[model samples]
Target: MVQNSTDPVGWEHFDHDADVGVRGIGVTQAQAFEQAALALTSIVTQIESVEPRQRIDISAENGDPELLFVDWLDALIFEMATRRMLFSRYKVDIEGERLSARAWGEPVDVNRHQPAVEIKGATLTELKVEEQDEGQWLAQCVVDV
Candidate 1:
């Protein structure tokens, strides 16, 4: 089943049993975090209309990509909650497992970007990063909307 049409960030049931869990996938860890952030944005406002002008860099250890991914999203959330900043587009660099990502977007404008819901947090549920034999990383994440 679906949750709400108002949410801009797309989300689907994790399984047939309960609707508590949802999943989002991307081509890389950075993309995955970007998608997850979009999901949160969709919940808050119309993501399609969110202008992608703000830019910043996010880098962390290579030991745990998952933890880094969470930190990445948290940074975005903090930007919004504290400074009311929102971001679009994620450029991530991963060597072995270390991550250095850059996000591009602009500050949140209540009149312009009508956020639908507040993103409480992004979790580690069903977190995964793998390859499709082509060598490109595929990152999957489930964030709490």
Candidate 2:
């Protein structure tokens, strides 16, 4: 289900047993990828509380779009775990099965941005990347927390 946000491009979370599912919808594949990253961030903390103070570059490649989506999310999860940061903004560029992007946010502030869970990784469960009817693209997968 889509979130109740005013923007046409947005993200949403869904139930997936012990894990959580993150979904992104937008007019373009890149936009959907960006929104999906936001959804991933929201799993950790309130996205609005994460200021875009630093930027991190990330890239991934795969022949299949679905696998690429998993790679993308895994890359973000790796960054978050290693850097101890939470991203609030993302700029994604996709060409074929290759993806390059920049994520912007600050280091985690426990008091200001209370984290809810630590995402271990993105899983193949319910993995999907496709363009829906009406020209909307969607990217989604279940994340292990």
Best-performing candidate as measured by TM-score: 2
Candidate 2 ranges with C-alpha deviation above 4 Å: 5-7
* Candidate 1 per-residue lDDT over residues 58-141, each given as its tens digit: 766747766776666666667667767676566666676676777677777788887655666666777665554342344445
Best by lDDT: 2
Query: Residue 72: error of model 1 in Å?
Result: 2.2
- What are the lDDT scores of the predictions, listed in order? 0.59, 0.92
Score candidate 2 by lDDT: 0.92
Name the regions of candidate 1 deviating beyond 4 angstroms.
1-33, 132-136
Residue-level error in angstroms, candidate 1, position 1: 13
Candidate 2 residue lDDT tens string, 11-40: 999998899999998889889999999999
